[model samples]
Target: MKVTSHRDEIRVSRLLGASRYRVEKPFLSEGVIYGFFGATLGLLISFLLSLYFQGPLNRFFDPVKFIESDPFFYLSVAALEIIGGILVGYFSSWLSVRRFIKF
Candidate 1:
């Protein structure tokens, strides 16, 4: 059994291709930078839009009245802001990768 196992191992190693070399640290660093830039841009854009639209939005939905009350309003606004930022960041990252990383 041991002899067969060793033979099988040798055969498998011979059939398989050599291991790939590791990527350099610089490549990984550049990718991180690229992702960070996209996320930052998305967050900024989302924040500005949220700020500009918040007042009008609140006014339009004023009849509900609860949105303007207390911590609920603040919490809702914060959640919206966070969701907007995340969506923007994802899209921006996708665009950056698509545009810059050509096949």
Candidate 2:
């Protein structure tokens, strides 16, 4: 939970024993560089899944009639996915950070 005044620094760690950790404080990009690299892996997984399943998903759902009948159903599903992703992402991020700080 220590935020250095100079942002380009961080504490790396190793677990020495149960409930004990050894920290090696170092100067770096304060994880900005590592953050981007790590973040992209998550995005790539999401993108690849969406891309590869585009066809199979349609076959499974068979929403063509609904789309033809009214576009609102499709739009509603899209909106729900967007809203759900935002909520899940926000809460998951918060939960992880809180756990890390507590640890």
Candidate 3:
């Protein structure tokens, strides 16, 4: 049995095709993943809120004001939220792996 040490990050990085990509790919991918999560989270919250409020607050859930007025509005909001989440993930990845790469 071959045992790999945690310090073998370099070897692992190279095995991933290249050292730079090892961190770059994860950072970018993590961002996209988190962004999708954020977008879904926003939509889910909106849905739940719509269901929770039945009286005057129900107006807040009107498709005329929120969903129908502009389809692009929802897309943009989701995109923005996704970007935000991705940025955070990217920053976190950078911070975590910055020290691991030597060249």
Best candidate, TM-score-wise?
3
Writing each residue's lDDT as its tens digit, candidate 3 over 45-78 gives 9868867775566566565554436878868977
lDDT of each residue in 1-103, candidate 1, tens digit only:
2223344443454457422111122233444465556556666787799899999998998888662478787568766656565566455545544443333
Candidate 1 TM-score versus the reference: 0.42
Whole-model lDDT, model 2: 0.47
lDDT (tens digit, per residue) of candidate 2 on 31-101: 33344445555556766899999888889888664434577875676556555555554455444444543
RMSD from true fold, candidate 2:
10.7
For candidate 3, which ten residues in a row score worst on lDDT?
1-10
lDDT of 2 at 79: 59
lDDT of 1: 0.53
- Ranked by TM-score from best down, the candidates are 3, 1, 2
lDDT of 3: 0.63
Q: Rank the candidates by lDDT, best first.
A: 3, 1, 2
TM-score of each: 0.42, 0.36, 0.53
Shift of residue 1 alpha carbon in model 3, Å:
26
Model 2 bad stretches (over 4 Å):
1-68
Question: Whole-model Cα lDDT per candidate?
Answer: 0.53, 0.47, 0.63
Candidate 2 residue-pair clash tally: 0
